[model samples]
Target: DDSLRRFVTFEPRANVAMSVNLLVEPTRSDADAGFIVLQADRAHPMSGSNCICVVTALLESGRVPMSEPETVVRLDTPAGLIVARAACRNGQ
Candidate 1:
């Protein structure tokens, strides 16, 4: 959308060309969260970096509970459901 493009464009640090807009929302009981990746011109495919970033953000921000040793994060993306295993230690 033009609004989204304008929003990202105004961010000095965010490169409008390479920047992607991630729409995160609540999902079914099976998944932790759902996301849709939007690029400047079109909707992009699933991105590994974006997945990692979302997972990390969810865990770090306390949106998803963090468990020591390992935590399973189920992400609902446009491509499909992604199961991410995150290694956690000392609440990190």
Candidate 2:
């Protein structure tokens, strides 16, 4: 989907929204998810908000398994690991 990358833009040099990451398959053994961060200028390791978006996308989109109460998502970023617990109700 690199071709679709053009649709997204980073501007004003904001710390939080200056970059974004795309989730991919894990490249390591200890990771449940893998991601690559793309900045306005260059690519980076990770972003906290981007990680949140990724985990949410995975669960909400049914890419990751879900449970009635909670579901744990262990992500592997280029920088390190991210563990997220998502609360679910009515498949949300």
Candidate 3:
């Protein structure tokens, strides 16, 4: 229902509370290269053969996003990362 999908509150990422983990935050690019790359941690608690994550466009920068449907991307363990790219535009 509409109520179930409504925005409730703004929640800040708790991981940012630590300084060192800043390097571990979700990677972002500003190269104006018209693409986004995603690397997933295999051992990520939410990962499975059918597990998936949502990639979203950051509104402040005005970059377009791309997504693949039902992609089987998760790996077995956090040994190697899976790389996926999404197209973007810099208004150029």
Candidate 4:
């Protein structure tokens, strides 16, 4: 049961069948959003794969969409999108 709760699997590679894990949370209300971008290493999961280095987020609020991460603006990759690691937890 805890194992199921310990991982958020997502493929970093578009074709090689690999995944990565990252964690993020809002520190306060009225926050835009945040991320836990892990540095790539030989021991990382998303490593050794064809990483486009891009990720997207799908945000939802309890009541209104305004209180969620609505807009996405990537500023770090070839496509101008920062790479996203997978979320290894629930309630994302």
Candidate 5:
């Protein structure tokens, strides 16, 4: 898994100590994307920040369709399924 470790490594010059590593699965009918979150070199049960980031990344990147007022994102995680509501404006 050296490749994966290298991929997730944050450049020390950037002042980042660690980075969240997400293994994203193909989009499913029920969920936009499924993923497992890895942090501190191990899998975590869940992370609020990680979930929020995932939702935002999906919508903003057009991985999931964005609605004007709101976007619903379904995330499949190791803990369980998470349904997140994202407030959107001007494609942001």
Candidate 6:
């Protein structure tokens, strides 16, 4: 699948620490994105901190736009859908 392909290409060999969040485009209508929480050996469902990380990444990387003071993003995970808000300033 695309998720495994992405993990193989982006993790393990890279310098990134293990158990990082890998965000993908959502396959469901209710979500704006899909995320796979990569660990040293396996992938897990969405976690609180990782969810925050994914949301932050979306806003910081401009994959999702940031609003004046806050940006809301919905993520689809193995567990379920997660909605999050991020603080923004000057598009950061």
Highest TM-score: which candidate?
Answer: 1
Q: Which predicted model would earn the best lDDT? A: 1
How big is the positional error of residue 69 in model 1, measured in Å on the Cα after superposition? 0.3
* Model 5 Cα shift for residue 32 (angstroms): 1.1
Residue lDDT tens for model 5, 12-55: 42224555737488355687788766544566767888889888
Better of 3 and 4 by TM-score: 4
Candidate 1 clashes between residue pairs 3 or more apart in a chain or in different chains: none
lDDT of 6 by residue, 53-75 (tens): 88878888888878879888989
Q: What number of clashing residue pairs does each candidate have, in the order they appear?
A: 0, 0, 1, 3, 0, 0
lDDT of 3 by residue, 13-46 (tens): 2222211110133333422222111222111232
Candidates ranked by lDDT: 1, 6, 2, 5, 4, 3
| TM-scores of all predicted structures | 0.78, 0.72, 0.20, 0.25, 0.76, 0.75
Alpha-carbon deviation at 50 in model 6, angstroms? 1.4
CA lDDT, every prediction? 0.78, 0.75, 0.25, 0.31, 0.74, 0.77
Model 3 residue 20 CA deviation in Å: 17
RMSD of each: 2.4, 4.4, 13.4, 11.1, 2.9, 3.4
Off by over 4 Å in 1: 9-13
Write the residue-wise lDDT of candidate 4 on 25-84 in tens digits.
434343333333333221233322333232333332321122222333222222223423
Rank all candidate structures by their TM-score, best first, as comma-separated numbers: 1, 5, 6, 2, 4, 3
Better of 3 and 6 by lDDT: 6
lDDT string, candidate 2, 1-92, tens digits: 55334345433333445566667899778777798877666667777788878888888888888987988988888787878888889988
RMSD of 4: 11.1
